[model samples]
Target chain A: MNTFFTIVAGFLLVNIAAGLVRVYLGPTPADRMLSAQLFGTTGVAILLLLSQALSTPALVDAALVLGLLAAVAVVAFVMRVPQSEREADEE
Target chain B: MSFAGLVLDGLLALSLPVLAWRALSARDLYRAVILFITFGVILALAWARLGAPDIALAEAAIGAGITGALLLNTVGGLSRKNDKDDERPDEPTDRVGRPWRTRLAVTVPVTILAGGLAWAVLSFPAPVVDMPSLVGEAVAEGEVSHPVTAVLLDYRSYDTFLEIGVLLLAALCVWSLGLSAVRSTAPEAVSGSPVLAGFVRLLAPAMVVSGVYLLWAGTSQPGGAFQAGAVLGALGVVMVLTGLLVPSLGRGGVVRAGLALGFAVFLLVGVVSMLATGGFLAYPEGFEYGLILAIEFFLTFSIALTLTALFTTVPPREKGGGA
Candidate 1:
């Protein structure tokens, strides 16, 4: 079961690697930024699996903190990017 | 290790460099910043794989989360300067357009310097003192059950003291450089956003609770003051961003007191310890737990204040409104 969890975590890492494609081929900054959000979810999944695999429950707290702060970049992006700049990306 | 675990380790080791290279070489600033955040997440996982949960916790909060926000904020500022371009390039053309000879001149030395540092780290000699065994034995006698926390607060407390002092110093410097036009002093666009207000309202209590939990867990687990402080510090950042707290808060006497509380207390403790125990930073016999906890409690708050204060700028002090 530990091995199974470990392998599953590896696959999720691959998913994160794949998501980086959107970051590279971004049509907009928001599209690029969402890849990080993808990690926030997928990375938490990976951490949970690795905690079970490695028998270290502390990583779950790391996961909790990661999940909690995950939206910070998006919030910052929304706040910092001016309305004109944000709208300009659409048209 | 099993084949599955081995493969997982290999994949993580391989991808870290790939992510770093991609982040560094990317032409688009926004993409690079996003990739940087991605890299931080993987790096935290790598730390976890290496069995360093404390580092993993700090990296998850500071490396991935806080850094991403800061870099994104900076990129926003950078892009706001760059008008009429869909993709803003990060590097000045002068570096890219420099003659290959000049580029080589810079690159060769940097590569050598990096190699030398790597070699020095790799070639580190075993300590004559047998630090781990010594720490393990000493920690058994100490009140702090966790070796890492014991070492941080008891064994090498001088180092921790200086580090906290540095955080306090950074806040001082930033406050001194107040009224910098680079700061956003006007009304916040973020404060008016209902989504953010709702999110922060939900999250702030969790952060506060977790921060205290981390500090409490330091006695027996990988969590400690730094991790707790990072969470609290990030909370302050969110408050400032949402305009729940004004930037001018950093300049206030109360904030300055909060910022210096840990440093001053740590120093006083050391001085009193020196006189009381005949050794600086030496906890009194059988009172180790209480002393460490007291220091950690104050250190946590000051660290949080310092982190938040560094990111803030304030209007210049008027006459009689001095630090």
Candidate 2:
């Protein structure tokens, strides 16, 4: 059972690494920002799996913190992105 | 170790350096910052894998969440400055005047040093010394149930005391910089956006609950004041960004008191303990847990306020001024 969890976590981590390709080849800042959001969600999943795999329930707390605060960076990005660039993208 | 676990560890080890290289080499500052955040999350995973959930929690909260926000804010400021100077908007500023040889000269020793450190780490003897037994014995007489908290707040509390001092000093330094004038012209969140306002309303309470939960759980679990404080600090950032909480609130008497509450309480407790127990920061025998809890509560409040203040670049508004 623990091995199952570890394997799943490994696959999820690969997915996260794959998402980095978008960050690397981003045509716009928004794409890169989205990749970060993806990372947050994926990271939470990995933490959860590892918690079960390692039989240390305390790791769930780390996952909880990650989930609660993950949207913060996105909020900062949206608020700080230039008005002209935002408008250009929207149009 | 199982084959699957080994593969997972291998992938994590491999991705760390690759992700770091990609982040550092990214041409766009924004992309670089984004990649850096991802790197932080990955690093947090590594910490978890190493069985240090306490560090994992801190890394996730402060390293990824707060640091990412700070970097994004900085990137925004940099891009705006570039616009003022009519520089290219998408690309980061070009390297100025430093020759490739000079850069390589710096990189070679750093890389060798990093490799040497990694080699040392990997070669550490099997069966790492178990400190849990020692910590358990020490904490059994202390107030806190959690081993990390016991070590941090009791056994080696002077370090924690100095840490609070460092945070306060950092806040002082930021305050000394004087407020950025561009703050007045900064873009405000659109007030008409119901979606955003509703989201903030929903999320704010959840963050508060989680922060408090982390603080309370610290006595027995992996959560603690620093992690909880960071979550609350992130909450403050969200509120400020959404314009629900004005930056000037940071300067208010109540907020200022909250900012000083942790250090002041800690010092007062230490002094009182010294007078009563003949040792600084030594909790009275029967009141150990209560004192630790009291100190942690105030510490969380002050740390949250300090972080929020540091993150906000604008100066406080004058009384009676409308947003």
Q: Highest lDDT among the candidates is held by which one?
A: 2
Task: For each candidate, report its DockQ versus the true two-chain complex.
Answer: 0.54, 0.62
Per-residue lDDT over B1-323 for candidate 1, one digit per residue giving the tens place of the 0 to 100 score: 99988988998999999998888887667778888889889999999999988888889988888888877766555544333354434553544667889889999999999999999999999878998899999988878999999999999999999999888877777667654323432245455657777888898999999899999998998888888888888888777666666646646688878999999999989999999999999988988898899999999999888877655643432343221
Chain A TM-score relative to the true structure, per candidate: 0.90, 0.90
Residue range B216-248, candidate 2, lDDT tens digits: 999998988899999999998887776666645
The deviation in Å at residue B70 for candidate 2 is 1.6
CAPRI-style quality class for the chain A–B interface of candidate 1: medium
Q: TM-scores, in order shown? A: 0.90, 0.88
Worst 10 residues of 1 chain B by lDDT: B314-323
Best by TM-score: 1
- In candidate 2, stretches whose alpha carbon ends up further than 4 angstroms from where it belongs are A86-91, B80-130, B181-190, B314-323
